[model samples]
Target chain A: MSATDELVANNARYSEGFEGPLPLPPAKKVAVVACMDARLNVYGALGLQEGEAHVIRNAGGVVSEDVIRSLTISQRLLGTEEIVLIHHTDCGMLTFTDDEFKLSIQQDTGVKPTWAAEAFADPQEDVRQSIARIRNSPFVPKKDSVRGFVFDVATGRIDEVV
Target chain B: MSATDELVANNARYSEGFEGPLPLPPAKKVAVVACMDARLNVYGALGLQEGEAHVIRNAGGVVSEDVIRSLTISQRLLGTEEIVLIHHTDCGMLTFTDDEFKLSIQQDTGVKPTWAAEAFADPQEDVRQSIARIRNSPFVPKKDSVRGFVFDVATGRIDEVV
Candidate 1:
């Protein structure tokens, strides 16, 4: 079976015990922008319960325009008051620079992308930068609570970016 | 205290019992793109354990250039072979039109986003469209295993988009 088919079968078993819908707004009033890294369990690492936060992830957890778009909706519509940016150690994003990745993609498929990969040299610095982006965005109604962290993949501990 | 401070405290408690890092590659070789719905527990609803999948999420789980960028990194670097897209019911993305949201944001921030929200009227069709986008992308090397699903938020059941 495909991995998704396996997931479907697993969902069948999971939904057998389904109770009811959780609320729309995140209980903790926070939204998370983190890396889509396989090893980083954002919820478990941060002790986030199911309905406590909105975790939005991308390649590097880099704060792109799309992240700001999501944060806009998250704060404006869903009542999420704070944004927490998390980047982890040994992320795949740290593997290549934007120009390098774009060139590779260009060689692979004649199509060049306009968007920057938002690659950075340091994960901690990336988190700090994302925090700054969110803090400076006019879209986020509650920017004072925004913060960033770097997760230690080895220990599953998060250190503040400050 | 800010919500992020609460998360820091929570992480402190969690880190005390932290086991260790899971492997870098997803055991299941799957990457998931899903909505950042507070009520949608992507791991629990799909029965995914930590380290089993790389989940990329945004406001609508829309398949944007960044998602393709992440998937490229997932396949080219991290060894993920499969992509699964999931959209859920009662999505806030369905609550507003792009024109409306754009106007609202423009009014609020005086900055206009060039990117579309990629919002849709139907969740199932949105999943299908995202699946097609992934399949057509040259970035994803393993397009044959791409699949889509709509998770019924009320029942916590996932229906395959096929």
Candidate 2:
């Protein structure tokens, strides 16, 4: 079987009899914003169950305007009362300089890099700034809680940032 | 050894000499925004390497305002030109109603649920709405491309959402 096929088989075996949605315990819904690096498993790290929390991820886990808009809706329309911002060490976002990324794209696709240079630098600072921005954003519930943490890719340990 | 320790050891054994970052093909400096559901592995599914793309994840894979702001920075500063939104089947976001979540929090922490009902609801709609919102948001790069896909938790096949 191909790798994809093997993956599918594994999912079937592990998720068998998982009929539809699982029961959710009565709790205040929590939302986590984290990076999508494959190495980090938020569920395992946070010890969360299927119905425990909402997670949103984007590159660098930097809170963007779209993230804030969604957060607004999630707070105003959904049920999330708490927010967790999780960034990680050894992240891919930290590896590339903007110029190097652009050159790679140009060489691969023959498309000159049209993107600017400010987007991919210093991911840790970006996450810290995002946490501050989100905490101060008017869209977030003024009274709701927000916390930030960094997950160590090598250690599998999470360190609270603020 | 504890389960976590054993798992970490296995990861180290499997990943030894696999360090120094994954290579990025030029045209694929794409950013993936996905959900944090354990059933989905974005990198394995997409056949991506470490530096090829930045993976951002959270609940429902919904694009929030914060995500948009981050995307803007990524495109303008980091050289990323595309966005992939990946939502998966059997997501935990879909399993709970607002009341149950609130009550669970109350029971666990002995604290009253301060948030109202509007904070959390259907995750599918949340994902769909997030896609539309991101596509139309002014914060995203004008030339940047965005697409949405639904990942089958059972099959590992990602189907583009039309």
| Number of the predicted model whose lDDT against the real structure is largest | 1
Which candidate ranks first by DockQ, i.e. highest?
Answer: 1
iRMS (Å) per candidate: 1.5, 8.2
lDDT of 2 by residue, B1-162 (tens): 432333334444444434433332223556677765544555456655444555676546766544564565456545677777777776556655657655655665465444332233544566567678876765455444566777776555666666
Model 1, B1-162: lDDT tens per residue?
Answer: 777887888888878887768788899999999898877778888888878999999998989888887888888778998888889888888888999888888898788778786668999888888888887876677887877888887898988887
TM-score for each prediction? 0.95, 0.54
What's the chain B TM-score of candidate 1? 0.94
Deviating ranges (above 4 Å) for candidate 1: none
Candidate 1 CAPRI level: medium
Error of 1 at B13 (Å): 2.9
Q: How many clashing residue pairs are found in candidate 2?
A: 50
The per-candidate TM-score of the B chain, in the order shown, comes to 0.94, 0.77
lDDT of 2 by residue, A35-145 (tens): 755555555556554445556666566676546644654564455677777787765566656677556556655665343423445556776787788876654663346
lDDT for A145 in candidate 2 is 61
Using Cα atoms, each model's DockQ against the true complex is: 0.72, 0.13
What TM-score does model 1 achieve against the real structure?
0.95
